[model samples]
Target: MHQQAKLFSLTDKHEQDAILQALSHFVSLRSLADENFECTWHDTFDWRLFAAKQQLTSRPHHQGYVATLIEKGKKVEQASVSGIFPSFANRLPAVSLAEKVQKHTKNRALLPMLTLEGTVRRWEIVDESGQPALELQVLQLTAESARTEQHTSLNTLLQLLPLKKRSNDFSQNFFTIVNGLQSTKSLPVDGLFATGAAATGLVPGDYQPWQPSGLDPQVPATKAIKDMIDHCLSVMQRNQQGIEEMLDVEFLHDYRIALRRIRALMKNFAPWFGSGGQKLEGELQWLGRRTGLVRDMDVFLEKLDILQATLPKELQEKLMPVKVHLWQRRDRGYAMLRRLFSSHRYRNLTAILTDCRLPEQREGDAEPVSIGQAATDTIDTAWQRLRKKGRRLSSRSADRDIHALRIAVKKYRYLVEHLRNLFPREFANLKRFKKIQNSLGRFNDASVQAQALEEMTRRLARSNDPSLLGTFQAIGYIQASLHQQQDEYRQQFFQQWKQLAQHMKRA
Candidate 1:
């Protein structure tokens, strides 16, 4: 658990020789055996390890090969086998490593991300007692892209590893030597990873959504709306590949969220975009419906265990058929979703969105206003709408009313989130808003689950299966439990609403 410091230098043969020559002036430096090998970094096709800031590399070691997992530039885990390095399938169990890496990778096939062939020059720095105090490794890397077969220099990685007892002394000596050389630049822990990715023309984590910064409050309303739309569209575009490949559930979740936000923007700012707004709104709604089934199934499947655990053993056994049915439906839904994403309509919509531009003005357009004024006005309107809807709900209010309130809260939440950057200091009680939203969300989930149970019971009855009696009884019990839970949330809804209102008033 000793800290390792690394420095990166872009050096040619002459500079490399000069660095070694300068190191001779410091405490005695002894050259260790030089080693050369080809290294390849592997990860899931979704770049899971890279996204998590982890590195898995396989390189020649001793008479065999070693696979090392590095986290934050420190080697945390490693396993080596006494034979040639095999493919990922055979390598995992052969090395006797069976925990974190295995679980994270699961059954996903590992793909080589970056291939680097390099020579590593090792040196041992000794104290006055002629005892090894620190170790230095200089890696001269050349990265090649597996996709294009193009090559680029990844510069050099210079790492200094000090023994635990000599950390402070080594730190002082290391800085002294570095200061003396005055030619090398130190890099952050992940610097080498970024450098390697860049050299191979692969940008890691490039698909992350954009967060707005430095937004001008006095900007035009149309310009502001365009910025918000563009940001949401970018998020959708970023998750497109993940959705198509079905790499993970998050892709569809994020894609749907982005589209929902876009729809919200279009609704709230309809007057700002002229007639184009209506068309964009329709397209966004279409996209949302297309992805809705898969998202709903994903949520239910994720919580299926918890739902089943609420029932007795016999009941649980009867519910297994429903679970199987849900899974089959989800599979079919995902297949359809994949096809939809690959369809011409999706592509054309994406292209149109990418090239979208707000019109200068139209007959029904709102009078030009500053973004700050619009944001303040919108927030006020949304808050008032939510408050009005929430206040109308009583203990005996219909489920539809509660559902309407949930939608209101969602709209207000999205508005605040998207525009919070412009007025950061004003919304000091965002947590209160979030609490109210969550309470309403739970209430809605209870309502939806009850309806789902009813529908499932009817479907099972129509099939006339032998387990129909047990399943029906189980569904009724679950529906009753959900209704009781819903009542609990219902009772707390007013208090939550009041707290949110008080906070908004103060703000």
Candidate 2:
């Protein structure tokens, strides 16, 4: 096996020069070209590449960019791509690197993470026979947060970059010996990513949006509730930048989920939040409604491939009118959302979340209840309600009943999720419940989409646009398709509900 290299961090130029003088004792050293290049690292907002133990860096190469993929801290591959790097993964030239990008960063934009802009003073280590066996690199870098507009000056560091030909000749023991003599600290083989994160003030890639599951069942109800609420709000707050820039639809998706979870916590455990609860709830509701249309359109457009797959190729192509109208509606929704999100009320809401203030205690408040007891009561109550609703659902049930049952299931599911720490058995069955809940949700979505199309057609009719004939045809076709989908999804819901009922009964 080949010996890897050592990268040492040294603050003083004297320390680096000392290491170089020490290196002259063993191997012949020759100066190499000074490298003055800027390298920008790329990864998803969540650090997907780091999660996969990969790091991607791009540097200017001739007329294009050379993207290098480092797998587990070793440079593995490189691709020279023309034009500006894209946010979408597949936009990269079709190659091994792009495939990895697509695999890890599906549906997320590839964002420039950290950048190093400075010079690398280089030296070559010559082995016997006068061939270059290894390379020495002294880096003085200006670290910048590619995620933001800040630059930081990093101290000069020394690194040994082993060449392929020197695999058997030079060894890491020399680095180990040299590192021991000085106060210099050698970076770990995979420490570059961690070092970058520290230098850039970026959190580790292990970050995930907060979930209720992280709450403790043993804590007091009010305290746990506050923590969960604040965490979810933080998740929402973090995504504001991505949403404002319209960087990706997922930013809004995550924002909405966090918002929904916050509402869910309040809805299930309303009494725990003593004061200002109703007002906060009202604002949250208003916020949800404000983004509802755009989110709906986002969902529809995102699932368009599946929707199109259900139709024939000829019909799918002809359904361009539906697509166009949907895009127009989505843009309109975004226009409205942008205004609301940027408004004073939105800023106030954000500040409230950011403040992390404890919900005010009402006058003459009672002692807080333990989360263990509160969670048990809440989970059981919601479960009983769901089962009752489930028993009432049938083939002849009104759409209202089905919708009511769907909402009930959702409320129950959210409770179980939020309090799953107290009840593992219930949480274990969550996947089953989620399957049924999703079916119900899809059924409702199909109904809503069909109805929305009808309303759109009416508006189009009022306009009396001559080009709307194709649109009308497409709308009718889509409605028929949606109705068919509603039936299938409904059947799936009932089937899944039966299985859930059997499991619950046995439990």
Best by TM-score: 2
Model 2 lDDT tens row, 1-507: 666777878857667777788778877889899999588888888888888888888898787788888887777877888888778777888577788778888889888888887899999876666777678888888878866666777767777877764455454655766588665787887655556667778775545785636566567776777777778888887887787777878888888888888887877777665577788889988998887778888888876667777765656676677788889988888777778877999999878766645534324456556778777777877788789888988877877789888877777776777777678899899999889879888988888788888888897789877877766776677788899989998889888999989988899
lDDT, candidates in the order shown: 0.73, 0.78
- Which pairs of residues collide in candidate 2? none
What's the TM-score of every candidate structure?
0.77, 0.90
lDDT of 1 by residue, 330-381 (tens): 8898889878878899888888777877665435546667777778877777
Report the Cα lDDT for residue 432, model 1.
74
Candidate 1 regions with alpha-carbon error over 4 angstroms: 1-3, 14-119, 123-126, 143-151, 167-175, 197-211, 309-319, 361-367, 421-426, 460-480, 502-507
Overall local distance difference test of candidate 2: 0.78
Q: Could you tally the backbone clashes for each prediction?
A: 0, 0
